[model samples]
Target chain A: MSLSISYDSSFDGFLSVVFETYRQRLDVGDIVPERPYDSDVTPSVDLFMQPFHVETNADSASRLRRAVVNMAGEDVLNLLETAFRSEERGVEMKILAYLRVLFSKSDPGFARNPTSSEMLPLFLLARAVRHEAGGMLGMVRFNKAPDGSYIAEIEPKYDILEMIVGHFRGRFPNGRWAIVDVKRCYGAFYDGRHTEILDLPDTDTLSRSIAEKAPPDEFTRMWKSYYDTMAIKERLNPRLLRRCLPVRYWKHLHERQQNLAGPASRPTA
Target chain B: MNLQEKLNILGDAAKYDVSCSSSGSSRGAPKGGLGSGCSAGICHTWSADGRCISLLKVLFSNACKYDCAYCINRRSNDIPRATFTPRELIDLTLEFYRRNYIEGLFLSSAVVGSPDATMEKLVYVAKELRTVHRFGGYIHLKAIPGASPRLLYEAGLYADRSSVNVEIPSDRQLQYLAPEKNYESIFRPMNFLAERKLEYSAGKRSRYTPKFLPAGQSTQMIVGASGESDLQILRLSAGFYHQQRMKRVYFSGYIPVNADKRLPALTTKPPLLREHRLYQADWLMRFYHFGHEEILDESNPNLDPDLDPKAMWALRHPEFFPIDLQTADYEMILRVPGIGVKSAQLIVSGRRFCKIRLEQLKKMGVVLKRAKYFIFNPDVPANLRRLYPEMLRPLLIARPKPAQLDFFSQLQAPSLPAPAQLSIAV
Candidate 1:
């Protein structure tokens, strides 16, 4: 039979198709673009999936490959693989856009214009992901899964699992831990022996972690004391603080200062 | 005065000077040092409205003996005045730093007491933060005009970056607005520090080099407050960069904090757009190979609010348009209206690999809408160049008005990732 095509209609859908195309070695027809869409299907001829363009795929995928080269270089394909692991779709387009501009004027072409292009965009994106990951990285309040694996749940605007793993891998390379992007449901991990991606636990199950036993080390009380003393009452800019560290991220943040850990789990740590 | 009262008066009085920057530094903590410098870039976390707030910027004291008309902290004003002791200021900085609140300190002050005494107090803060506290964090101290050279040198040793304010755009304005200060008091120390920094870097004197402000010196002018035009500011900034060995010339749009008859009462807010344009032109001069005299002149003192400096320059010098990218010198590529330093470099480099097609240049992030009128690459169709002027006029005329987009975008993230991998997924 002729190759069968499925429409996933999301970033993961695009990634799933990409993965499937690589796996099946299929001569994929049309991939939907982020912009406008037009379709002309001729059943008699080879099947034509929806015709679309990726910002990267346009100009023979120059933007995409250039971005991959810029970000991951010889190993840029690895960044592409990690990017695909992201549950979101348009993110890849923006990622590719960001990468292409970054690579254009580095050493090979360091002509001038230090403040021009990619600098602003790259800064905005990296900081957005870094901010989310750093917040979760510092304040996740992990607990032991039945498998003895350390697990923490997070909901972030950007694909930050790779970012989180990068930091955690450095800090806890020997430990078994998994940070689940609870909203997207799929999570990545390093269990001391191997690294893999797996479906995350259901919300109901993660909620039960409160009643479950806690790790012996628990929360560091000194860290909480340090956080409380850091704010200068004289220089406190709650308006500025709220503006920088949005209230959305506050849900995942642990105010160990007040001995509060989980949401509605009360004033108890 | 007590620490709290001092902080209130000094911080409030110093807010309008507008020259505390944490850019172009890279020093890390020294051995036995408590802090490190990350000058390669400082984290300027801007507010939603786009005001950068990473430096613990404050004044040592605002009780100035000099009566500069443009200054709110002038001795003639009846505002509250206070001073920070070395110990109290150092304590505040350490406490704020441990909480991850600020990256460095931007300490400036009006000339309080004698110039020697004021400069000594400022030096003491930096000295304590460095020698006693072992703090290695970035420190930007302002060098007071007419201060003793020894005090200026002492301030330089403990501070990573320092500046002498050239408040007025020109000497004529200096006489008009700030009569107490003159070019000799300001330029003398600046010239000495510049020479000293050169001497230190050359390793001529090993023991007493004293770092001498490793990030280099910067000066600021109050744009629009004085009657100086944009051309005047651009020319001065260019001169400072080239001749003075100054790292940056920060442009502070004149905001009338106090109603003074000597200072021009702005019918509108200090010309922020003009300040923004001056900054863009400054970038071009520093990195884009544009000359000060070449960019502006007596004919046009201010930049066109409707068009960017590059575009306006292009319209002025239309004869320079349609430069063939393949044969154009690197400098000429930088002059093209739509092209920037980055794009110009790309055009030159990409030509090494293959003929640069219009399509290819677009992929390299060329804003063809403007560049098409100015650049003529061999790979581009001849018809594109022949009709360049006619087809390009609309694009130039239809240029989108400058917007608040850049400021808002910066606020969304605290730091930027490398350009190539900046995915929206960030």
Candidate 2:
């Protein structure tokens, strides 16, 4: 009989599932995240495939981690972690299939091949997550609160709030800043010395309140001026602008709030 | 003028400088500092023209002494001009930076007084940002030609990248367009920065040795201004890349903002395709190990408007094609028309595990439409042996539609807007 395995939707929990599956010789019909893990836009769940819960084992997780590191290189292990963190539906099983492919091989060079069906899906998934995270690194615009703290709200496609925190932390080592993932309602708050991932109140309300508190500053006016004047009128390309930056990101990007399609292209309504 | 007016005027003037890349330096925030440079660079947004807006690109000033015919802020033109005090520039940068509106500052200036005086003001901002404010963000300072080597050295100390735009391709053309500028002034600062970067990185490091030009130097050249051929531009770009630590060589398609006897007709379209082709050739030279001579020679003085430079080169030398993907080296695979750097690297590593099938080749990011004719496998027809250059040329070349001339616009989707708000009846 085929078995369905479920874990607590953490990296450690996923690793624990990898260990438990190998030890029990579970014929994995499906592997799943316990807490309603939804993909980017759609809320999807298969009614036929329900998973029985498996307790997360730290010892099991660590042993598998060491084995994967010893067997394939750290790069392979990193690829797996990045893939799992992609938070896409059916990702857990895709990662499992990839791990099966890796553990089946003796030579680490076999893991380098990305053309296989097992490996390619995981690579595409990891790249999607990393690509979104990279965009967030640039796209997050912090609005200074009246309290002298920086607060920014983002609604990323994936759960990448934790992924991009390192960049902001490094960029502003001495300033207090908070980046909140509005969709997930959690944030990484940096206090100049230490960073804490805190569950916050409804971010929509928080962001709206912050906007009311601090009006646009002089520098923001300066930035808007700089942004507007930078475009050469002769080469006005609204078509190219939409391609580089997808429109969904415009909802959160403060500068794109007004008629940012520019006066030339704004007559479409 | 107020700070707002200066920012708008100077920002508009500096828009044409190009080179807004904030990559290649991992300048982390120091203890008690405000920001760090992103190694891969974060483009905050793209401008209306589809250019990346990574830095707060603005001129420190636009009050010019030289009368360059191509420039908007030339001494000959009577545009409203403005210059920023060092304090004002610093304040503007820090505030915008803290709010994450920009990655860092890209400060270029029209020569305010002499080149040395202008360069000193630029250097003063960098030094103050690093030493006084403890700012650790990316700074790209335009090394004004004819600035003293000492000032350029100090500018290198604090800035991640220092670049000097050799505006015109050849010296004679430069003399015709920008008479006050010459080859010596442009090359002098470029040579100094390259040598200094080499000096800093060559030996064992002491604790006190500061990083000099961590991102190295870059240069820009205007295309189609003096009617220089693609051959001339590529050769000059190749020369700069060969001679110095040129991280990037930017190509600006000339927009005729001024009328001069030596310049092209005002009605002539800016040679956008030629500028783009030059960049593609530059990319091939840097990444694909393509020599400049291989790209352009005595016969073809221009890049083909229909086919890309790589495809053109492939058609010119048909002997290289029908490459056996299984046996060819990475460099040889890269030379194939459809395969890019990513696919080439993938092919080399992937063939180790299993034979790459036709289906798997598409999965590996190969553009099957373009790559099918070049690669040899069981799936690609054996009858292609009779395929000659002339027939293949029409098949491979994408005949340019007006929008298709820009590769980006070919894939561009119309902007998605949220449902429009209902206008209430008055």
Candidate 3:
């Protein structure tokens, strides 16, 4: 007798697929995959693959949603976010396997230790993503982008493009905005209507792109003037400033507007 | 001044202000805007001293026009000076934020021009950071004394927090030392800002209540820099706490960075231990339900420098000791010398389940050395009752000195000229 297996790409899809596997009880030796692949199904294995096509208006999606609630408790579903963020595919599978065991056991451990076994993989992934998100939180220099929306460019260490955008969305809830992760060739766009993640051309090579067709406003001048005027004379602590704000992030700040707009007064490097 | 030079001077000049406590502000990053507020920003580093360096705590420019005698950057001091454009400071803040270096900006300046002029500059920096940069990060701007109320109010709209350092602990001390700054100059704006914050909060408007320093206004009083008794200083602190609604009364033990004849020579290192004791007293008053009068009365206005106020109180009020653990109220337990806030809560919670024995208290994480002599119950072993006193003193005495006061350790023995004499600022 051959054992069969199936797969689903998303967590929700996977839950639905798993539910079908148990409910249909098609055969003792057959399996189905949520995502289709160009592989020959072994005659002995008896495997089947299906794309997780959520019928846009289908109430069946709610059944899949219910399966998610049953298999992984709402809390586990939340914890699985980190696993989904894991760039490593193996970790994601391990997380899924762990979730299966949890659902199968219906153990209190799923509820008791949410951040531990159930959520640790996702936490590790969120931790990595948070670094870039945090850096973007600190460094994304906002300038007036074309069409009056605010735009910032960042080079984050993780694929936290969505998290970064989400943080900014709260900070400037009213503004139309976009933050492109220079390294990952992706960005999140928040129009007044909705926020969407988008992939972009790998524009990392362009080092000195100007804001497209936007004039320097009065606030910029006042900001420059204010910066020029506020530092004290008797107590200069460059060492302290360097320690606090490393020079690495000075490239995009609006204070650099003067240096960027004018001819280079001195050698930066 | 050049940007680099300004960054150096202003940043150094601004190091002494200890008012920035980042824990209160929990706002995250904005849409299309960069940076979120973290309790632990780079400049926001909390030292063993427990001081938070969350902001670019720097002076706009340290060139002073007023001759405040206690000030190291007094107008007459022949010190190297530098100034930054607001743009540079904000750039530095953004860069630091990006690099996880600083939480926000803590911009103070010596009176370079008239008070209005100096305040206008501070206001401009805050305004630029908020409106131009759309920066929602924490900002603590210093409200220069004698600045117009309008400027002060405008400054609040842009910054999260603001303060005017009271300098000396008392008006008399202020008169003797910082003649250019007086109680009215400082308190007027403080009072106005307090009212404004109240008004804004009461209006039930936007969640962005435009906090006129949500961390609340804090004032630095130069400890050991003035002749005011600890009692006098604490009274002033208490008054500020009650009337001005000051969030913190920072005690900066004067370090005597400059020399002057009118100032008193130090008998010992600027009373750092004394300053530390005052901070402990402050903490007790704030958290331990200690009343200002209860900690210090007319007979002994100053707390004993050798022991923490709570310990000293316990040693003096011995009648309250050997409190019955099983019968004591949580508040009474908290008042015991050995019991801290956490221990008191534990005792309250744990006692509800069963009769608590002395050994069980230790297992449940009670501070037995201090609490042992103060608490008694049927479960306490007979040997434990006799042995507890020995345990108490050794534990209390062995407590690690507060790190900030360790600056006084150099004055260990009187034989070595009592360290360098320090001139009192007030």
Candidate 4:
């Protein structure tokens, strides 16, 4: 008989479901986020099978965390964290299926096997998330605010704000900075001491504030001029530029923006 | 002149140098510093040509004293010239760093008055950045040729990396193309920095000893400018890697920037494909454990532009294959055409649990089409006996579309796997 398990939409909630599955020795058919069965039943689900709602108790979540770490290793926890941050649908279920294989193994080192069917999806998803986060470390551009603070905004595919904050914090320890995820409506603010996530104001309010407190006109103008002058005229390849810096990201870039009046013209000798 | 104008003239002059990486150092921010260095370098942006813009690469001054034929900023070239004061450079770097526009500065300069005077000016900018600004960001200074050893050593203490360009590969060509420069002016400083790095690391003089050239030194050799063969260039690069402990050896395909008689004619395009092959061959030597002789020997001086160096090496040594996936060592497994370092490790790790099958190899990131003939396993059919190297060469070489379709149909498209997808265009 197949069993369906549902839980709150979170990493801890998924771990809670895993703990309950082991405790009851239930044969898990599918692990999904808690939703009204009649309205949101997936086509893949059997018509007869009913899912049992699992409460997200902190005790069970911690217990499952310890069990997985003890059985597999510390690396599995990192893999799960990265996979959980991925935007791919059904990543929760994939992680559960991967852990089920790890729990079945005598050594539990099977979680590290990238070629295994159960672990491959989780590994690929984790790699994708990590790759995006790494790319953002370079592509993220900040502008100086009037208050002597730095501010930048990003629209990333994955939830990578928390993953990349530590890098900026380490690099800019003395300065106050804010990196907002406009799509997610949240921002990570570092106050020269610690970083914390805060709900960002609405777009209208944020844009006005940023416009009012922007850096001197000279900095932006000079930067755009440098970007234009740096490209070699003989080796111009727009295809390669688009490949590296996708058009989607050009919205927030200072150099890619259009219609900025400035005195930063090419110097004539 | 204003900063924007200075930036244009200097940035244009610096574009051809081609070492934009800010990697190999992991210095953290100081007590009240504004920036830190990441070990895995970050590229702030990519130029239109797809080259990374990691550092704010700019020349300190573009008023040249030497007329190198391949250089755009040669003394005879009619180009706008500019120079940046030490204060202006430091302020620009800090402001850019604060805005996260660049990782750090890649400061080079043309000969201003003398090599020593130019070297002193470059060192002053770095010194003020570290002392006055407390900047911990990555700094790569260009060590001027013929500079005093004292200036080079002082520059090393402040800069994370330093480089001196050996524009021409050989001394004879160096004399022919750039009559004012020779190999001794370049190699002397490189040898000095390499020796000083050894002494600093070995002496362990202080508990908090500062690193001298922490990212080590690198040199760029202009390819296709001189008439030197690929074999000679690769041999020289290998010697640098082994003896000098150089961090990187950059290959800049010669761009015909001037109408000099010594340079290759303007009709020829830059040998970018040859430069790409050299980089691939360099990677093989560095990471894949292949020697320079193994990659390009006296027998074959130039690399096959159609195939990668690894595939070329594998095609020549047919006797080494078909290697067994289950039992072959890591080094042997790495020699397979399509298997990279990551996939080779995955195969070794996966086999510990169970014998890796062909499908598992594919999932583990191995490209099976190129590796199938080279590797042997239980899943491979008995009729698929290893053929002679020459017989297999034609199959691996990428053909045009119409011919490729005919070849695919003749080989039974559904039954046999397709060839490896060529990642780099020749």
Candidate 5:
């Protein structure tokens, strides 16, 4: 009989499900995150299997980690981590399928064969997340807070706040900064001493706080002036500009924000 | 003039330079420093022309003694001129860095009195940034062609990368365009820096030896400005790569800035296609293991503008066709039209356990539409076998569409957003 496995939405939680799948030898019909209505499912002939809740524990997670490392190489762990971070539906199932292929072999080289059906989509998803993270490394524009901290907000398609925090910490050592993943409702913040991830409040409260601590008008004005003066008039190709810096990214960019002010009213600073 | 006006004049003057890379250095933030450099470059923004604005690319001064025909900052050009005080430039750089608007500075300049004087000022700025500010960000300085060796070395110590532009490929054309400049002045600094880099690297075991141009040196060659053949240009570039160990060779399609009688007519559009093809051929030489002669020989001194260099090479050498996917070596697999570096690596790894089919190749990022003609895979359709290389040539050539005939077509129909095409990996 098929079993519907459910767990908390996290890497360790997913690992716990994998651990239970092997321990019980259950035929997993579907692996999903725990939902409120999971207990209220009406029994049917086609869906006769009971839902199984796999509690996430360190021991079980570590066992699955060891199994993955032994079956596949160490690199597959990174692929799994990056792929698991993606916000795509059925990504957990895909990871489970890929791991199953790896665990089945005595000497599985799934990492080597990136073109395989089971691994290709996972790699692509991981690449997309990485590409977005890389773009954010450049696109993250920080506004100076009144209290000497730097504040920035981003709504990345994937959960990349954790991936990009180290870069900012390295680039701005000793400087207090907070990078909020607006869509994810959490932020990675770095105080002068240490870095931490915190759950953020709503957008209205965040924007109000950001405005209160925003840098002086002169800095933004100077940046806009610099951006406007950089482009050559004769070689103006907006198509190419849009290609390099996509329109979606322009909303948060300092230069693009002030572009609507027109050249006449630009501040001299 | 005010700072904004000065920026306007200087930024416009420096826009024609195609090199905007802020890569190749991995300098960490020093104790009490402002920034750090990541080995992989970060492009902060792109200009209207689609070029990356990685650094605060600007000229220290637009006051030139020599009159180059193609340069906007030439002595005879009637344009607004400005020069930034060293303190002002330093302040600007630091402010921009704090605000996260730029990666670093790509400081180039026009001849101010003499090459030695010009170079000294540039080196002084770099040295001050390194010593006083303790800045760890990427700095690309222009190595003045006729500067003293000591200044060049000092500049290298402070800068991540240095370059001396060989404006015209051929010496004759350079002399014809700018009488004051010559090949020796440009090559002298390049050869000196190249040797110094080698010397520094040889004693790299010692921690005391300071890094000299850790990003290495690069040079720019203006295409279509001179009457030099692609063969000559590629030959010179190969020599630079082999002998001088140059990091990059940039090709800027000559943009008409002034109405010089000696230059190609002012109305003539820049040779964008030729420049693009040269970049492709350059990529072949650097990454794809193709030699200079293999890319462009005496028979074809120029790259075919219609087809990419790899496809053109495939068309010319029909003898090496239908490469078996399962048996061919990694190098041979890389030669296929549709297979890129990533896909070729995948092919080699995937073939160890099982024979790779065409569908698997497509999944691995191979452009099967183009590779179908060149590769012999297990799942390749039987109908594709009837067609020959000659029949595929016309099909492969990317023809301009009927809608593209309109002058304002690009304006009306926006092109899909994509990454910068010219940022080459070293």
Candidate 6:
């Protein structure tokens, strides 16, 4: 039977779809991520198959999570979670193909085998997710909020806001810090002890005035001064500067705002 | 001067140091702390010169008592100088660290009064960060070469890493450039910290045992300052790796900061290309299981200006060419010019599932432009670039303008020294 499995686009919701597909032993040709909110980019849907909407069941998701963790191991679970976090288009179908391999015990460790054809697409997606997460761990810059807390805004290509907050919690355990995604208008906040996700509405200036942000505060001025005098004029290589801190991330970083990242200073005798 | 002006002066004075690593140690934030350590280093931002701003690198003071010809902060130079109090430095580090501006502090300095006096201030700032504030971030202290062993030990108790810069490659060259400093002063603290680190690691994991230099030590050698060949540089680096267990060896391309009679001309550009080649040779030694002697010998005393060290080594030895990708082990596979650590691991693991093909190699991120010549596979059609190693060199090397690439043109180097093992008390 050519059945199209529709999920609510949440990690648990997608896992329940996997649980239901196995319970009924139905052959799923495609997986569609159904979102309650409007998205301009229409998701992939297999037109030939009858659509099967699976309601998100927490018990079913938990059972499958335990099963995958128990069978394939924790690292493999992380790989699958990264697939969900990646939010790559058509990733649901790739995950469906991956789960089919996982359910069949012919190659019990197929999830770990990145070179295999079945796991390659998921692996590539997971790799992009991980790379951005690592970059965010360093690329995130914080400015002090008026209420004596740290706040920053980022616009990453992937859904990585949740993936990076754990690092901040570890680095700033006693301080309150919040990193918001301006595109989604959502933030992951650390409140000295626990972390929470909340909708942030006051990030309009972040997207609007990012490039025009001058050094208004003393600390920003110090950082800008430090960054300016740090580079040796004789060894300026723009190619390497772009490679380390990419052009896509320049909007948020205050120092990279102006066109002073390249070789500007002449060698003073 | 105010804090901003002081930061600019001290930061500018400390800019020449190229070692920005914050790796090889991991510590979590303390109970009421401001920062934590990550073993995999994170670069907060890159400067205009493409250098990683991993640390808030600054000097305690640029006021010096000794005049080293290559140093910007030397006493002879009349550049604007400033110093930061321990309280000011501590606050700056904590605030910058709390705001995620940097990983930690890289506090180096010129001698204010004496080595002991300067080392005491650096140690005091680090101790306050560790004990009073519970700052768990990566702290890299400069183990002042001539500082007392007790001070170095005290600094190590609170620091994740410490380094003593051997500014010149050979000891004789160092004496000529910076006559106030000697080989004994440079190596004494290094050898002391290395031995103490060994004791901490080898001893029992007792509760009282403090974590001492968890990231160990590293050093930097200026590339173009002295007339030493690439051969000498690689040998010193290899000894540091093998004997002292150094984590990293950085090469600064000797930007002509101060112009003394002994130093390069003020207008002379830094030897960036030679610095790049030396880094490649260093990588071959550290990661590719290559010994320093095997990289550059007495016959070829200098690294080739055109080709990378690995490619040059491959072309020199014809027997090692045309390595069968399917049959070659991991070490030999890594020797192939374009195959990196990641691609080699992929080839080793990927071939188990299917017979490796040309397209699969490209998918695994192998740069077949160079690797195709060295790899022996049925899918790879043989060409002149592969058949003749000499023909391959011209194709691989993109010849930049003659004047731009020739940093050695100004060398007027002294004649080569004997190739007996470098025994200058490294």
- The prediction achieving the highest DockQ against the true structure is 2
Candidate 4, CAPRI quality class derived from DockQ: medium
User: What fraction of the reference interface contacts is present in each model, in order?
Assistant: 0.00, 0.80, 0.06, 0.69, 0.63, 0.75
Query: For model 5, how does the per-residue alpha-carbon lDDT over B1-426 read when each residue is reduced to its tens digit?
Result: 888778778888888888988888887787887788888999998866777888988899999999988888999988989999999898888877876788889999999998999999999999889889988888999998888998998998999999999889988889899898999988999999999999888843755568989999899999987789988999999988898899889998888889999898888788878988899889888888989988889988988888888988888887887889899988888888889888888788778867788777777779887888888766787777546667878988877776546668668776854445434431
What lDDT tens digits, residue by residue, belong to model 5 across residues A117-162? 8888898889888888888888887777777777887767777889
lDDT for model 4: 0.84
Looking at model 5, the pairs that clash are none
- Please provide TM-scores, in order, for all candidate models, with all chains considered together: 0.65, 0.90, 0.61, 0.90, 0.90, 0.89
Among all windows of 10 consecutive residues in model 2 chain A, the one with the lowest summed lDDT is A260-269
**Which 10-residue span in candidate 2 chain B carries the lowest summed lDDT?**
B417-426
What is the Å distance of residue A156 in model 4 from its true position?
Answer: 1.8
Candidate 6 similarity to native, TM-score: 0.89
Question: Considering only N, C-alpha and C atoms within 3 Å, which residue pairs clash in candidate 4?
Answer: none
Error (Å) of candidate 4 at residue B128 is 0.2
* DockQ of candidate 4 compared with the true complex: 0.56
Q: Candidate 3, residues A1-269: lDDT per residue as tens digits? A: 33344444444454544455445643323323332221343233323432222213234546755655686567555545544543444444455556556657655545334233434455556555555455455566555644777666665544456665665566556667777665555677888668888866545342234344333444444444434333332334455555444455445544433464531123142
CAPRI tier of model 5: medium
Q: What is the overall TM-score of model 2 with all chains considered together?
A: 0.90
* Model 3: CA > 4 A from native: A1-269, B37-43, B46-51, B203-210, B266-268, B324-327, B354-365, B382-395, B399-426
TM-score of chain A of each: 0.52, 0.84, 0.54, 0.79, 0.81, 0.81
- The residue ranges of model 2 lying beyond 4 angstroms of the native Cα positions read A1-7, A19-27, A34-51, A55-59, A104-109, A209-215, A259-269, B399-426
| lDDT score for candidate 6 against the true structure | 0.84
lDDT of 4 at B216: 89
Residue runs of model 6 more than 4 Å from their true location after superposition: A1-6, A19-38, A43-54, A104-111, A200-216, A259-269, B206-208, B382-386, B399-426
Between candidates 3 and 6, the one scoring higher on DockQ is 6
Model 3 over residues B107-205: C-alpha lDDT tens digits? 899888798999999999888887777676788889888889899999877776677888788888788887776788788999999998888778567
- The prediction achieving the highest lDDT against the true structure is 6
